[model samples]
Target: MNVDLDTAKEGLAVLQQYGGQAAAAAGSLLAGLASPFQLFEGGWGLNLLFFGVLGLLAYSLVVLAPRQ
Candidate 1:
């Protein structure tokens, strides 16, 4: 296949721009998810509560998953 240099460069630019946007979106999503964990830093009680809740959520998901 014959491809023009300018056309390839334009395609690469578009891909790079899309990748950057995707990275930014992923970063924001992770930051939002992690924001709640910051509360656990206040004390050991909060840390234990956070882990307990997380464990319960994990267990529920496991119990509720579909069986083949």
Candidate 2:
């Protein structure tokens, strides 16, 4: 196998770019979740409402599923 330095460098650049993008996305997600007080103050009750709905749906599924 003929390995070239330029190809390796290009691969590393591509990897760095992907890592940067992933890091940015993760940072945004963390920032969004970190300020719960601000979120709730800013009319984020819908988040909790959605969670409540999800819990009810899960409970209903468990109750309605056939037991072995």
Candidate 3:
């Protein structure tokens, strides 16, 4: 009975450690995904700038592409 209790406690400790790591990983992933939209959170000027930069980048890619 004592051995069984020790084994169960060890198992629970390992599970808790893994669970904490998983939660931290999930939070970091969410923050990374949300970072791109943070530029738009600054309102109209930032939004315009973001779109303008994106457009310029796209135009550059098209203009600089090699002919097939």
Candidate 4:
């Protein structure tokens, strides 16, 4: 099937934006995991706990956000 040029470009733009976001998230997670001591200069346990809390916040925001 032949796709319109503008439609194809829009699709590519969306894909690139999503990829960049994913990469940034992965990098942050890796940074937190790779250097627990360096992450806020605390131990791995604390670092993990921080990530857990962060995840919970995001989860709650998604699940509890008012639907449009």
lDDT of 2 at 45: 82
Q: Residue 61 CA error for candidate 4 (Å)? A: 50
- Model 1 lDDT on a 0 to 1 scale: 0.85
TM-score of each: 0.58, 0.50, 0.53, 0.53
Score candidate 4 by lDDT.
0.83
Worst 10 residues of 3 by lDDT: 35-44
- Please identify which of the two predictions, 1 or 2, would achieve the higher lDDT against the true structure: 1
The window of 10 residues in a row where model 1 has the poorest summed lDDT is 35-44
Stretches of candidate 1 exceeding 4 Å from the true structure: 40-68
Q: How many Å off is the CA of 2 in candidate 3? A: 9.9
The local lDDT score (0 to 100) that residue 12 gets in candidate 1 is 100
Q: TM-score of the candidate numbered 3?
A: 0.53
**Model 4 spans with C-alpha error above 4 angstroms:** 37-68
Which runs in model 2 stand beyond 4 Å of their true positions?
Answer: 38-68
**Model 3 residue 6 lDDT score:** 87
Model 2 clash pairs are: none
* Model 2 C-alpha lDDT per residue in residues 1-68, reported as the tens digit of each score: 98799999999999999999999999999878866634345565876786688889998789866563
